[model samples]
Target: MINKIVAIQGNHPSKLNSETDTSVFLAHEIQSKNYKIFYYDPKDLSVINSKVIASGFFIKFNYKDKKFFKILKKQKLNLTKCKFILIRQDPPFNLEYISATYILDTIKDKVKILNNPTSIRNVSEKLYSARYQKFMPSTIFTQNISEIKNFFKIHKKVIIKPIHSYGGNDIHLLNKFNSKLINQFIKRHDHIMCQKFLPKISKGDKRVFLINGQVCGAISRVPKHGSFLSNMSKGAKPINVQLTKTEHKISKLIAKDLKKENIFFAGIDFIDQKLNGDINVTSPTGLKTLYDLSGVNLAKIFWKELKA
Candidate 1:
């Protein structure tokens, strides 16, 4: 039998926002069920003598406390012993991240990993949305300057993003084609995601949360003044919002596809009912913010689904 423990492979708790972190929120809920929480950073994961292990510590989470989390004891753990392991690290999705997934893949049969390591490794967060391009704004994935120029000519306004980045970093809004900027961006990040700029983003974007193949909840994040990015890390304010019929339909289709791919949790974004190309499976967030605005505890739903 699997022990009542959930191992989280993520960043240090101190770096997380207590009010909006989904990892800690889920951990806290699972802890209430008397499941021990083992927390570790990706750097501490390793494979030795054909076994997966991690240097980590047991932790307790408290939402109302100023400190929020407390470390109980430090230990080296065999990851296969846990009932579940969540790959909750933030991403540039570089070699280090890929290596961690490879290591975790070895123990997957013995533990329930939220995303299924192999599946997350195969799904590129931004690029995967291409499969649903019909629901998305006009977008392209390329490093070709000429292709980007053509896209710009058609759309007039465009947004350029590093395909593997997270937290709204290195995203640029270009009103007109600038050869220098486009060339420099391509040189810096290689392949990139370029899309027609959505004007409605000034109002907000909705992040729909899918857990266990179902559209569980959603929250709208309105960008701060003078910004186009609606990520919470970019100071976007989340508000309670209901999904439109179209949004609900799109989310359901995506959720069904993700489940078939063995992805257990994901977040997808939309602006003015049009899908933005972020299929956020790599540590998808927003449960805490949703709860804060709507009083719906997605964390409880998360665990209940896992139990079922």
Candidate 2:
């Protein structure tokens, strides 16, 4: 039997936070299936002789161990040899990220790439939510100071965040719009997403996990004291919760679209039944937190769909 090899494109292990790291949890989950995990950074991939080649080491991780990761071997592999490739790197979605997508798009016919590289490149997590704005809160995509000011005028209280950002970084809750700061924000981020700030966010936001375009499980991420960002990485606490009727309806709608887009997995947020308009696609996290709080093993469901 040919050994199933799953190649993961991600950040170096040195930079990860093991406590709530989703990639590490996923790697460990699949390891039990007797599949070999090949780890590499997106920067380490190249096109050699019309083939996708990734230079990395095979690592085996387990919960019970003195040394957590045991390296089996190192090799330069043509991606065609890989049964599955997971593009799991966190993103700024910069030029380098786009270039990697272009490279990976080449071998997609032969190798199964999760969350399809071409699909991810086409979908800018925050911006892609624009298409379903009727289900979303008052939102706008602009870098101009005047436009943002106009949005704030209508929404009163607004949230301003960078289009290319994730993990709740650079997210700002503006009660009163400041033109100068808005100008500075636009200058820095190039394009920004401005939306009506939902007061219910103080309670929590629902993060729905979709695997193979199916809503598998979800968890509510309650913000820390006096804060509104519900990213687990941003110190939000996960809570066991069920999706409301409205949340389930919206998830179903988006799930169909995601499947059409070839997005194998995605994480989307909701506050007070209103779509937050941040569809976290590139390295969508919070799975470990979900499992910890809800006892719903989404990682198992994720691999089940992948294997199917």
Model 2 residue-pair collision total? 0
Instruction: List candidate 1 stretches off by more than 4 Å.
Output: none
TM-score of each: 0.98, 0.96
Candidate 1, residue 212: Cα displacement in angstroms equals 1.1
What digit string (tens of lDDT, one per residue) describes model 2 on residues 148-243?
888888889999999997788999999997888888898899999998889999899998988876887888988999888888777788898899
Which ranges in model 2 have alpha carbons more than 4 Å from their true place? 1-3
Against the reference, the lDDT scores of all candidates come to 0.93, 0.87
> Could you list the CA RMSD of all candidates, in the order they appear?
0.9, 1.5
Clashes of 1: 0
Query: For residues 48-97, could you state the per-residue lDDT of candidate 1 as single tens digits?
Result: 89989899999999987999999999999999899999999999899999
